[model samples]
Target: MDTVKIRNKDMLWDIAADLHFPPGFDSKKKHPAIISVHPIGSCKEQTSGNVYGEALAKAGFVVLVFDASFQGASGGEPRFIEDPAQRVEDIRRVTDYLVTLPYVDEARIGTIGVCGGGTYAINAAMTERRIKAVVSITGVNFGRLSREAFSGYNPLGALEAMAQQRTSEARGGEVRVDNYLPCSVEAGRKAGLTDIDVLEATDYYRSPRGEKPHGATSGLFSHRAAAIGWDAFYLAEVLLTQPLLVVIGDKPGGFGAYRDGQEIYGRAASKQKELVVVEGASHYDLYDKPEPVAEALEKVVPFFTKHL
Candidate 1:
């Protein structure tokens, strides 16, 4: 396998990398392609994306993974924006890059998104006609999903406070950032703190499982910008015409999250939608664990082989 950097003039970022797989000696045809997108605040070195890219590449598919704009080596102003809309464009931009390569079979291009990337992939696939298939791992439905709004605060009061925050930000004020991962959950701690979220996500981002200190960030979005766009369940309502695959954990009932995927799948114009729930798996297990990772990829490769 080989890796190379791609300069995207559209996003004005030179932060994309493509991994190439050598075709078997008997085959002289262009190889299939897959793009793996990392989760929010994550770079291409992430375990979830790296394994998927390298594994797919060795399977004779060209895999490209990259850091989103403003994070890692990518160029962008005001780092750590964590803008959902921009991330979808990043994935679409990758598709734009892949089709230009001589070794890539343009017709056989698909995408795999893990966690936050799952939503971006779904959205991009909904908008971009070039994608034939897609897979989302533990994807979050940001727009519709009931989020932890500064707990105990009145909804109306919170909105009023947010209004003031926005007013301040509009006047050239710095945005307030929130760190979901606190290393430890403190006694009588901050509202909306959950051990499950902090522990699991922090383990991956802070440890070798998917660690990359070079390109790490946290919640830096303007409360106003994020709130204004909250209604757009991120391509959730958009109809997808391509065959789609969704993988999620089955044990201990994390399936509630899959409801977002189901909602989208139900609305899909395509007849080839599927959902697979892996046994004894959690959302984060697929991040690095080899057994589960292999199992998940086995399902994804065939989908691309037949479609991309």
Candidate 2:
């Protein structure tokens, strides 16, 4: 594995990434490649690089795991803004970088995204034809999640609040940011958040199990309006024609990854698509648990192997 910087042309910032080569890799021969995108509020070193990237590389593909622009080790000002459009473009930009490598087969390039990253990957593959295959693991359509959050009340009111905060920031108010999860599972329980996904996410991201200095799980509060207004599966019925794999846990949660996977499976225009529900698994369980992760990869590896 090699740490690398991918150039983001539109933002003029470098996307920090890790490039993993398969065992006995030969640069003289072109090999299929994959771009592993991290979850929102997470970095490459967590699931994208640490789990999927490493596993896929060992399975005989060149995998690149990257930090989205403005988060993690990537470069951007007004940090921690989770713009869905920019996140989609970041996948395309990573593809642009991958195709430049002599050892990469551009035609065989694929992508796998986890959590919010899965949604962005689906969004990106809609227009980015260079990506021949897509795998979305526990993908959450963030727009739907945001609008439905807090019991589906006052989405417009939340947008209005974001507008006010953005205006204040433009006028020199301090930029407001916050973590994506509670400090810990115990804290979340104390706060009355008993959702399995929420608690497991807190355990995975906020604990030593999956924690990294770059995986700060922070986001700009004002910029959330962008996500609330955007839909990751928009036009997927017409535009998403590539071979796709949607994986989700059986247990549903407030975050709605399971629903998103079901909707995408039904809506996508892909001639070849499959949805696998990992039994007894919740959203966060697919992120890192041994059995679930292995189960997911068993399907993912062959899907990409055949499609790419």
Candidate 3:
């Protein structure tokens, strides 16, 4: 594995990435490649690289796991921003870099997105034809999740607040950031956030189980408006024509990864698509739990093998 930096074309930021080569990798021969995208509030080292990226490389494919711009080790100002449009563009820019590599088979390039990264991957693949195959694992559509977060209450009220905050920051106000999950499981329980997914996310992200210095579970509040307005499956029925694989947990949490997986699987116009629901798994279970991760990769490795 080699640590590399990719230049984002639009923003000119350096996207920090880890390039993993397969065992006995040969530079003189072409090999299929996979771009493993980390979840929102997470970095390449957490799951995308340390888990799936490494596994996929051992399975005979080159894998590129990257930290999205503004998060992790990537170069960007106003750190921790999670702009949906920029996240989608990050995937495309990664593809741009991959295609330039002499050992990469550009036509066989594929992508795997975990949690919110799944949504971004699907969104990116809609217009980025270079991604021939897509795999979404426990993917959440942030737009729908945000709009319906509080039992369909006044979702726009937060949007209004975010808009105001963006303006304030533009005028030199202190930028505000918030944690994606509770700082700890006990804290989440105390805050009445007892959802299994919520608690597990806190445990995974906030504890040593999955914590990395760069995998900070925070995001700029002002930038959330972009995710609120973006839809991962928008026009997917017409434009998402590549072979797609969706691996999701059976448990439907407040984040709606399971629901979004089903919705996209039904909505995509892909001639070849499959949805694998891992029973007894929650949203966070697919993130790093051995059993669920193994199950997900069992399906994923074969799908990429056949498609990419």
Candidate 3, clashing residue pairs?
A: none
lDDT of 2 by residue, 1-308 (tens): 89998884565889999999999999999999999999988999998889999999999999999999899999988899889999998988989889889999999999999999999999999999999999999999878887887325678998888899899999999899977789989999999988887888899988899999988888898888888889998999999999999999999998889899999999999999999999999998898899999999999999999998
lDDT rank order? 2, 3, 1
lDDT (tens digit, per residue) of candidate 3 on 1-308: 99999884465679999999999999999999999999988999998888999999999999999999999999998899888898998998989999999999999999999999998999999999999999999999877876777224566898888889999999999999887787789988888887887788888988888999999878888888777777889999999999999999998888889889999999999999999999999998898899999999999999999998
**Alpha-carbon shift of residue 283 in model 2 (angstroms):** 0.5
lDDT for 295 in candidate 3 is 98
Best by lDDT: 2
Off by over 4 Å in 1: 1-5, 18-28, 145-175, 184-195, 215-217, 227-238, 251-256
The Cα local distance difference test for each model comes to: 0.67, 0.91, 0.91
Q: Give the TM-scores of the predictions, in the order they appear.
A: 0.83, 0.98, 0.97
* Candidate 2 residue runs with Cα over 4 Å from true position: 8-10, 150-152
Q: What local lDDT does model 2 show for residue 49?
A: 88
- Decoy 2 TM-score against native: 0.98
The numbered model that scores best in TM-score is 2
